[model samples]
Target: MMKGFSPTKYILKSFKSGKEFKDEGWTLDAPGEMEPSLIRAIYDKKQIDVKDDSWGLYKFADWLPIGRVLEGSSAPVTYKSEGLAKELGLENLWITFSGYWPEKGTNMSTCSFKETEAYSVCGRMTPEMDKVLVVASAGNTSRAFAKVCSENNIPLLICVPEDNIGALWFEEPINDCVKLICSKSGSDYFDAIHLSNIVAGMEGFVAEGGAKNVARRDGMATTTLSAVTTIGRIPDYYFQAIGSGTGAIAAWEANLRLIEDGRFGSNKMKLMISQNLPFKPIHDAWKADSRHMLPLDDDLARKQVEEIIAKVLSNRKPPYPIAGGLYDALKDAGGDVLLASNEHAHDAARMFLELEGNDIHPASAIATATLIDAAKSGLVKKDDLIMLNITGGGEEKFKTENELFYLKPEIVFDINPGEDEVIERVAKLF
Candidate 1:
């Protein structure tokens, strides 16, 4: 039997590589990077300091370890989608699948990495203050956080685009303890983000500042840590779908810590990040080899991306231009970026299911497409260790529940409506 949980080793000790920066906030001290630090600070018995207390919350979870593959295997390795890799020339790769439909018999729950983030973020919260935690999601994140908050009885105010509310798993409503807010016109994820900031300005509520939250970053970083621990080292490359590119950033951070532990692999992992086609500003920028990208003015392009086969990976303003952004991470890591069309994503998904017999999420298929492109272009070596992050899957599980997750239509307003009118509508929620 396994021994009692060890928080020290899993969290406190592992965060030793943490550092703080003025502009970039707290970050891990990744090797060969120009950023300040990965971790802000650490808190332990008998002492507390400013650097460590930069963020209000300071707890961590010993999340589940990296899953193992089935050689002669037992228990059918949950989240291990074998067919997905072979279809993309990743025969000897590991799929760090998150989101819905874990092989462990859990149906597609909230359908996001938010579950992983919430488990770790909430583990850091305390009962001293009634934290009205605010989170914005296109769909999956709100659901994931709502489920975690409901089970933990954590007060939460979730914000999402009205049009995207239809994407939420309506079968599981936000817990009664959690309040929901929908942006006007069902704008995009950015609209919900703006709404979240407005809500955060209110009393008793705090915004879980997307990628800025250390808990959120580290929580997602667990994916990389799990992969390293399980595979016993960092791979030659890391591929994942990104909205904010936070997961990629997390992997960069975690790899640094693993290096410090001196037991994991080198700090030489390549980052291969991808965006959905039609509206991929980041991919376009990466391809152009430019530091910045102009926002797409093409309505058709935006529509195609918004209505993409893999809508979850779409982001209007990813953190690609900021300091220590996706571009920098990839450049420093000697990485490559790619864009996958809806057809490519769809075909990849189908191919993966047929070959590996695992139904991968559409976003994951985009990453799978990139892997194929890498193989054909000779960007990947035959024997190089690779880790493909299956961001989300298990859409079929939603059908079994026989119900749709929907949100109540809240107030609707213009894109940047009058602040007074917005404040009044928000005041009603409290």
Candidate 2:
């Protein structure tokens, strides 16, 4: 269990009851079976709360509190991936990156796109909420949320894989509001998730559901919004690599908003979701055209995907086929699915570095590989408005400023454990 200082405020709301955001708004409805209307309704009804002054990092210069770009990034356009353009055979391909690399811009807070999601989520947290307890099963999201919470002094408790602590690279050390906890030995992200849920259910803690949280969905969705706004139109096709598939879902929601905004584009954009090799259940299931997927349920499949070494993109059980699953989202968008092996991802990253002169994280490399494959297969046109969401990059950006970061699993749980230890830990926090 993880304990942290109490926060002075707490904010809660749903997608439906937001403060009447009306800039060419689009309805972010999940598929009929996987409808997010309940959350959206909450947001619409003002159930979800945010500070009146809260504004996300993605807001244009006109909206930023400082009225200046972050230190490293000069403009959003430079962050977009360029190597992907030539390979895709598209004249106008764009890759929007967020980080502290001088070539683009330094999201000096580190963890790249994860910061994008965290900042947006925090911005929406009204002062009414004393604190926010975010359950991050992975290092990226954990570091991201921790960074934001530290900066804002928002009490945040992060639950992550025991093995992932001490391993993450960060823009800086976390603040007092941020606390990291891991499960016992043999525990993974899922186990921490279960434990985090129990604690959140207790008094004064709000659980930031990983993929299910609308703030995360909307926050990640801003990549697309930035794209269309920068280019003045929605690309004919949008693509990204997925771990939990939330970013893709966020893109879908953003597209809907763009359509509603009307100035960017009135039509829906086709989505192309990519999976790294071996654990590509979503890709395989989509190719099979099966509405439902039978679990691979084999360690071998997991290992095979792990060999690709793009560990961040590995989500054994992606939300697919169950209403808001990957399959349903792609099908509704008239999109396609792509799978890339580790070899492919690495090669693409190498080629991109040479062509575009920028280093990209391995997970995002998977998307670049898919773009190349799609072009070679002639699946996309040369002139299509193709936008590749380079979710992260600039591994070397902070090496000069600080040392590398790492994750060290704190506890070792065989499986589920008795509640006594967890309860005791929680009690100590107050």
Candidate 3:
């Protein structure tokens, strides 16, 4: 452990078998899994004490499964909404803003909530571990990880789709310890994941276990922690746009913890999650009330991804069907999946800027559009307290404030490169 923190502060519990185990460096699953399940961090502290604002995201370190607190981190800023709430005629709408809005005291430099994952996942690392971490992303995640790893001097290898490379722009040149590799043009997030999986298996490389990592999920759970602590209680509904649906699952997990704390009321917030239209696998699966996703052809999936405005939400293999995943979270929380079209998402983005004073990501816009529809359709009552998680925003403002330097990929590989060829080329980068 890193000096002051204790590993015993939390235990990894298997979601399916109810088995608990200590953290063994990078434990993603239970020792002997009877069924596929998500491993969650069961923190020892039942009542969470928020640290000083100087701690940034570490304010909730009592709950996060991290060995050390990362510097320059910022927690989600949750406040009662005025502009959008009044426009929709809602009396108690709370917005949890997670990007670079200085006026709102939000400071996620990457302009994405993926920073929560990056900081906690990387913070879980110790000096004794000597392996390069491998991460895969559609865009936002890679940028967040790259920025964190670069600043912290942690060796990292990022695999992202070539089409989304523009999202890698940073305020300064990244450190040499962080190297990027791209899945060539026409590939999607799944292709990037495939390439990273092969590379992660190679010697001296460790996979940054995406949604499976307890640190990541617990880190994302901070969004809920921030909202509940700020709102003084759990909201009636929670809304967000998802690619992997991991954020919604994290929120559900946080709700359970807060309920156990005995301070927050024992109310399960309905998870009102949305997906951008045409590339809505989770939405389709949830709407059908199926634990398994309907078979989607590779070509058809890729075509749908191409048709969507929110490229970051183009995840082909989201953690929806697994035990203790999105499906279970939705069933327990009681909510429906909604869809937003590209045009409506664009309109919502503009409206958010005009009303909220900050531009949002495409995925966030989809979420806003869905919430608007819900309010207009009477799915949500006027006086009900609702939490709309603006997962990312303020990119346009950040761009105008800082000169960005884009990180160039160390190597670009075909969508499906041979394992030997990849191992050989990637090994040489170090």
Candidate 4:
């Protein structure tokens, strides 16, 4: 552990039962049978003080549930927007960027905000813990975690859909401590998750816990912290594109923390989260005002997932309906789910490049598309304080400056492989 960094700075609290416990490697459940809920990090510090001496996201270490700061990490960049704000006719618009833009001092090498989760989750691991950490992702997330664990020499096993294997490209060769696996071709994010769950059950491997991990959520929450700290107040509206809606929920959680801090004004920002059209499960559920997601046909869901341009936003089983999840966050934060068509998203991507001078991920494009609609339709007033979260960007720029190396899967499995076969095969990789 790093000097002066306390593992006891925060306690894990159940969002449903309000029970608190100490960090015990990978604890995702409460003491007994109860309603399903996310466990949260309740930090000891009520007012967050940015650490000037710390690097990257560690500057916000007061709230992040990390024992040690990792090298090569960077904080999200927040700046008052001049170009996109002018184009949208909004007066108080702030943009928080989470990807590579060395000019702005943002350096997430994977070109995705998922780096935030990777850094914190990996940081939470102690040297005493020798278990292999398992992660399941569609694309961007696997890339981020792979990059971080490879650099840090942390043992990691990554499972991603074979269709998204293209996203595994990196600037440098990955270390052998990190291993890659994939679900069969034509599989979706959920299939990748299924494979990961099977691996996590085996001995010597541990699940990364997805949205259930407080460290992951608190890491992603730094975007909101960056925005609010930079803007000096919480914006009236917060916009982002969601895959699992984890980041949006992170924003809402950060909003609650800021309100408690008593420095930033006590106002909850409306989370105007968007999903790509034809694959908007969260949007569909929100529209129907249902806590539980409406039944979606498996074949139709897989087909819809393939149709969306923003492939990273294709989580079939998002944490929307669970306690202390997206549904509850949306209700508390006063927001509505929005959808963005492929045409509009592409146009928005082009507009951002032309106006903002940066290439963004397709998911970020979908978020910008929704913001444009909201501005034009008077959902936001001309002077309303707004923060648009550019979840990922600068991939084109990064690629131009660096040679790319794609990671190859050591093992591949069908969507629903036999558990014993999986365990036997995956165990050999180590």
* Per-candidate TM-score against the hidden true structure: 0.80, 0.79, 0.98, 0.98
Please write out the lDDT profile of model 1 over residues 213-251, one tens digit for every residue.
566776677667656766777788898877778789778
TM-score winner, 2 or 4: 4
For the record, the alpha-carbon RMSD of candidate 2 to the native fold, in angstroms, is 7.1
Candidate 4, which segments miss by more than 4 Å at Cα?
Answer: 1-8
What's the distance in Å from true for residue 395, model 1? Answer: 2.3
Q: Rate the local accuracy (lDDT) of all candidates.
A: 0.63, 0.62, 0.92, 0.92
lDDT of 2 at 169: 53
Error of 2 at 242 (Å): 0.5
Candidate 3: segments with Cα more than 4 A from true spot: 1-8
Judge candidate 4 against the unseen true structure and give its global Cα lDDT, from 0 to 1. Answer: 0.92
- Write down the RMSD of candidate 4 (Cα, Å): 1.2
Give per-residue CA lDDT, model 2, range 33-77, as digits (tens).
333432331222111122221133534322111111221222223
Per-residue lDDT of candidate 3, residues 287-313 (tens digit): 899999888999999999999999988
Worst ten in a row by lDDT for model 2: 62-71
Angstrom error of the Cα, residue 124, model 3: value is: 0.9
Ranking by lDDT: 4, 3, 1, 2
Distance from true position, residue 40, model 1, in Å? 4.4
